[model samples]
Target: MPLKQPIGQKRLTNVAIVKYKKKGNWFETACYKNKVVDWRNGTETDLDEVLQTTAVFKNVSKGVLAKEKDLVDAFGTNDERAICTEILTRGDLQVSEKERKLEYENLFKGVATVLSEKCVDPNTNRPYTITMIERALKDVHFNVDPKKSAKVQAFGEALPLLQERFSIQRANMRLRLKLAAACKDEIQSRLAEHKVIVESKEADGATVAIVCQADPGLYQVLLALVRDLGKGHGHLEVVSLAVQREGMSGEGQASGDIQGILKEQQRASELSQVPYVTSQPASTTGRLRARSEEDSMAEVSYPRGPISGIPDDVTRKPMFLEIDGLQPGWEVELTKRGESGVVDAVFFSPSGEKVGAFVQARRAALSASKKAAAAQSTVE
Candidate 1:
């Protein structure tokens, strides 16, 4: 049997017949190389020799092989086809095992270099050397496809290994909060749920001041919850502390002085107050002076209009109005001639509870208009 073709080798056979005239008969032989028949001169020459005289011929060797039919289809002239075949038949296209190994090594080195620059050791806060990265890579087993580019192999396969081996540290944080009396219970419950270290809690009148420390990752979530609970009324301050180096702890150190912080908090609270005069009332109208000396001399008139059939009482202070729809039984103190007078009218139920203001006014006006129309109809 004929010898089997080697693996990855293309099958090539001298199947074309070439005939030449001898002394008395014609002789035939299988053609291994391409040939051309010059009918005009009856001459035969190798295709390579024929192409050397043409401008299409170059001194470069072929890197990949092409079949005879394919070469003919690719080029318009025989000389061009022969030149392409020669260059393709050369062995420059195939990469050796050693070269492929070297390329992969270069790719791995590039990946290590990138990680060294971009990533740092979490314990020391310093970048890892290339040798350290290479050592880490040795512990992990992975395959790199030679077909992919170096950048793809580095990021897709190598980067994840480096990141998994070396992780970043969570940051430490300090938080100070000035909690409002109304939301103190809710805020404390949330803080306890998060398990933050509450260093101190001091009561300054109705408000509670608290200082705590926690990990940044968990603190961020807790901070959002606190802000939601505060609803623009609470005050919070966050400070970032320097990262602790390896083998160091802040446990034994004395706590820093917080007296200055408390003093500042007191000053801020003082500034936020609205000052009012403490002088006696002018005529029992229950209107206190605005503390403006120039305006104090001018007589401030109070409105005498009744509210929802409840006549204004100049002697007695207006009762705090308990409204149903306003925050579900929340009470708002109303005065006869102050902010409450801005509305058209106020409404109260038979049980002496405030209902609504503007809505009741609209209903009363419509009812009175309807009564007038009915009376006119009866007279007609």
Candidate 2:
């Protein structure tokens, strides 16, 4: 219902006049009842312009008035304002904004799992503020206006707000591709297991169904990955890798793309002799064995990816590693630089089992050719 009653001659002294300077223009936005209304862009001036501009909507409960009052009461004094301004100038606000963004990202990590687990209404599917929808949608052509960007930001600030249509669109795309791939793989594996020749052709450029003897177990695995996405990092393990064929006979047709890629993958997997995956443990056994062989004789160990040492208060970028039974004066090499240097000292921790190897820059090793050249130059 429209608020028809007029606030006649009622002087609102405590009314907040929020004047934000953005892109060189001052925007006077009046907030009440947690709603933002009556916005105008003009010169930054006293409180009169904001009050006059918003007087028409004064009858409507501006929800933000309560929040504004709370904020003012919390830190309204000149001293508190000075502290806030100083902190903002020193980039504390930027850091705080970054922390908030990080929190959003961390929360969004479980979204795929949540979506996969249950059948949700397409209409109910909305992009929560936890997901960076604007960043995801920046490349989308329609919502490129500056006003739209601000609106998106505002929506993001009030988190758990749903962008239903947008979420459904992306979710449907992800789900379709994922389910299709799983279906195809399951069908092919079952066919091969039953000694049936699984041949996929893209001759007509139509959607191809993977044919196999029906197995109820494969379907369960698919449901587990899709529905239990949040549990056991299920979403991460469920791979939906795109299989693309480049410079194929088709010019503009997407007809052969899916069929060709699937056939190729099927052929490759058959050749490699992929065992029937009854469980995660059986599937990982081979890979784990290979990794164990690789790391067996080595005293130092690093994870498969980058080994950036833990972040410290001083923000030092040096790499640090603690290995068990690391002997003193042994060379330690970080793989990136491919340099092995003699350890400066091997400090034993209080536990006595772990040893920390510290190496200086100068004792680094070089390739045989480099060493040979240096020796020849010294002789000369």
Candidate 3:
């Protein structure tokens, strides 16, 4: 499991080693106790005494020392110290499975802690506990790469999966800002990085008005700016807020998630509302049985690949949807929450002789889209 621990020798404890390949020959170096030190920077005592061994080896785990001739040929020196320095500084460090597992676990929790502190429930505007974030991650079977930083991966890589199931959002505090005209330039400079919308030019000549979505910490800075610069002329109004996904419509508004999508005769229609659904989630365990061997579920666009992009790890609850035209035992199921909002519709047949399925979009989202377009046109 751990790169075949070279045969019968037990490697030394507290002595870290680097495995290097030079001119098709493998060499390993022994560094100071439990650390892979830079050979260029260590003091003379660290090289002479603390380093467990000066003899470079072909395999530390096997007790096989590198030959002098091979070392000279590969490194242009028979000197073990010089060769060891190059190998130690330039080579890859090998880690045991136990060590690797520990590092992996630490990094996984680090990512979770980062998310717990920086993100908030979009509904409640409160941070999720670390336990809750960790559970959601386990449900998604998230993999953490030891090479990447926990903070670096938290938003771009980890959060997307959690968002599909949880209500987590990177915290953004929506604040309504009003200040004396004299403080305008400084306030703008301070909040330039945040999502600041110039709400309106106020009727009073001496006042400036704006709406800014800022980090919770940034509120203190706003308070200070207004107190120090505006001379008690203005105040801050706080509103419920959460960070919106990039490229979504409006300043902080989210275009509604696709509740369901139906394709009838090669046409794709977006469904906004599920008029009727049972309290439980659908049981999507095995393959859906189709009407005929000649006609497969793949023929239709409703369910996406691998039984419709629904990963097996998601916590699924069974839900029942009713279709009017289906025969006595036949049924159509509409599932929600995974990948693209919904897993689309999977219709089952009772008799398998004459199987037909048709789905229609709920009109609320369609009507809203049209109304928004009309309002924008009128404004223009």
The numbered model that scores best in TM-score is 3
Cα lDDT of candidate 2 equals 0.29
When 1 and 2 are scored with TM-score, the better candidate is 1
- Cα-based lDDT for every prediction: 0.42, 0.29, 0.54
Q: Candidate 1, which segments miss by more than 4 Å at Cα?
A: 1-69, 72-93, 168-380
* Consecutive 10-residue window with the lowest summed lDDT within model 3: 260-269
lDDT of 1 by residue, 1-60 (tens): 999986674332432233332233222222232232221122444444323222221111
Candidate 2, residue 175: how far the Cα is off, in Å:
37
Q: How close is candidate 2 to the true structure, as a TM-score?
A: 0.18
Global local distance difference test of model 3: 0.54
Worst 10-residue lDDT window, candidate 2: 241-250
Off by over 4 Å in 3: 1-11, 31-55, 62-64, 67-69, 76-90, 172-194, 197-380
The stretch of ten residues in a row with the least summed lDDT in candidate 1 is 244-253
Q: Could you give candidate 3's per-residue lDDT for residues 259-358 as a string of tens digits?
A: 2100110111011121212122111111011112112222333342222233444322121222222123434443332222323344444433222222
Candidates sorted on lDDT, descending = 3, 1, 2
lDDT of 2 by residue, 1-380 (tens): 99899666645443433443322322232322111222222232333332333322212224222233333444453243332232222211112355446545433433322322211112212122212333323223222222232333333421123232122222221112122333444534544564432233222232323322112224445445444432332221212111111111111222333233233323323322454221111222343343234234334332222223322421112323322122222223221111111112223332333223232212221233357678889999
